[model samples]
Target: MSEPQHDVDPVRLGAYFALIEVSGLLRHAIEQQLQADGDLTFVRFQILRRLQLSPAGSRRMTDLADAIVFSRSGLTYQAGLLEKAGLVVRNRTPDDERGVTIAITDAGRALVDAVLPGHEAVVERLLFDRLSQDDARTLTDLLTPVRDHMRAAPPRSATPRRTRP
Candidate 1:
């Protein structure tokens, strides 16, 4: 019951390699800065940043995991750390007794605010500065469809929930 294999193309392989390599380098540098400056892990920073950007400044825990491409248990563990640090809080959603929402605290916003300028600077220096304005736009245009297509598919996670006792 093995799936049929297609011949691999060198160009496509190179593209995948470049994407992974660049993403790893960028994440490492950003994480170092975030840890040093804000005492935050990259995942914690992302959770805070996403919550900060939400219209209601909160999101259901599952939705946050899906949006961030994090495992539900992993996100919950990170959220627990953030909560312990007083950067976030988890609350029961009023309408759904079983639903839990993660909300950024004032401290979370402050940490994000403090970390953002450095984050932008690192990104600009490492990634964007290498590209011309047109290059940036073209890259975005090229990636948008690919990203959207992947997102349209069913989620990769089979059990996308944190196990609650």
Candidate 2:
């Protein structure tokens, strides 16, 4: 069957494609650097980095999943792997037996410290190097509202699931 046509203008379509392409390219490079530098996956790195940056050096699993826009199951699996590797610890919350809190270990902080320099360099070279300071500001301004609008939907951890009857 032929696809139905939509009435999107050429400029908007082009911008959407360009944004997608740039996102893919940036993610690819960042993933490679994370793997090579810290033997970490991009998602794993994000998890550790967020924990490391948090004031308490930890976060509840659901909050972590929401912040990273990762599925709860996937985050649980990754947290298990990190726990096995001695990079993080998962604990049951005292107030809620069902809740899990993930905390970065010293080793995890060390790994993030090791990997950050290369990650920053890769991002700077691949993205910011092409944009002037003013251009960067303009890009942020243009994208912030779109990001906020998209995030207005329920967070990944909060989204309801469909059940077959």
Best by TM-score: 2
Worst window of 10 by summed lDDT in candidate 1: 154-163
lDDT of each: 0.91, 0.93
Task: Specify the highest-lDDT model's number.
Answer: 2
Error of 1 at 2 (Å): 18
| lDDT score for candidate 1 against the true structure | 0.91
Give the CA lDDT, 0 to 100, for residue 100 in model 1: 89
The per-prediction CA RMSD against the true structure, in angstroms, equals 4.3, 4.0
Instruction: Give the per-residue lDDT of model 2 (tens digit) for 71-146.
Output: 9999999999999999999999898778889999999999999999999999999999999999999999999999
Clashes of each: 0, 0
**TM-score against native, each model:** 0.88, 0.91
Q: Let me know the TM-score candidate 2 reaches against the reference structure.
A: 0.91
